[model samples]
Target: MSNSIYDFRASRLNGEEEQLEVYRGKVLLIVNTASECGFTPQYAGLETLYRNLGVRGLVVLGFPCNQFGAQEPGDAAAIGQFCQANFGVSFPMFAKIDVNGDNAHPLYNYLKHEAAGLLGTEAIKWNFTKFLVDRNGQVVERYAPATKPEELTPAIEALL
Candidate 1:
């Protein structure tokens, strides 16, 4: 894949076109989320991290997915409402996108290629999978669906 994750673009929940370039120079945590998944509550911790680290150059990006167990079956509006009401999430959230299969988003494709999970496996097995990127736009780590956002504090601190 290419070195520039900024080459990709995706639509925001509000239908606004967002270039990955907008996150340039910021360390990012990209997550595939599901509203009803077991890991769904991570949104709270993610939001906390965002609130704490955002001023220090951290940007958390959430992408709601329904590909697994149909947990995130809601449309963009519903998903946004759920996150706002339950988690009080203030991070940037994008429209639903498959993180695996033939139609995976291009940004996810690059992330998987850059930092594959255990044994260098590129597939995202379930929701809440995370890809951490450095300020230079390079994917630095891939966390499993079970990895909680708080567990990544050390790694994120190191990058900061």
Candidate 2:
């Protein structure tokens, strides 16, 4: 596996295979999301961040994960609709993925390795856990599930 975040690829919500290299040079806010979790509301804040700072080179990538409480039970289409209709999330949304265990996605494994959670634990505790990637595709920080998306603006701006 490569060291950069751009070395991985994930399937978009629309069923398209997207090479992370496409986001190279752009600040990335990657999150493992869920529809029914308490933190699901963060989607709105995330969308806000994306819409407001996107022109400044920020992009939020949402990866729906069912590994946590089965909160994100919908298929790709349903997840897409719920996000768009509810939070008006316009940023990139990827297909459902496992954020832990043997099936964890390669991108997520890299993120965890680069920025472990509280106490240096690599496992994702729950949905909405976020990973920030700099313009050079380096994992810079990891945010707990409770951290609101709006709180990331300062860091994101700094990278932008």
Runs off by more than 4 Å, candidate 1: none
**Model 1: pairs clashing at backbone N, Cα or C within 3 Å:** none
lDDT of 1 by residue, 42-121 (tens): 99999999999899999999998888999999999999999999999999999999888899988888888888888878
Reference-based TM-score, model 2: 0.98
In candidate 1, position 124 carries an lDDT of 86
**Cα-based RMSD of candidate 2:** 0.7
Model 2 scores what on Cα lDDT? 0.95
lDDT of each: 0.91, 0.95
**Tens-digit per-residue lDDT, 1-160, candidate 2:** 5789988999999999999999999999999999999999999999999999999999999999999888999999999999999999999999999989999999988999999987899999999999999999999999999999999999999999
TM-scores of the models, in the given order? 0.97, 0.98
Query: Where is model 2 more than 4 Å wrong at Cα?
Result: none
Q: Count the backbone clashes (under 3 Å) in each candidate.
A: 0, 0
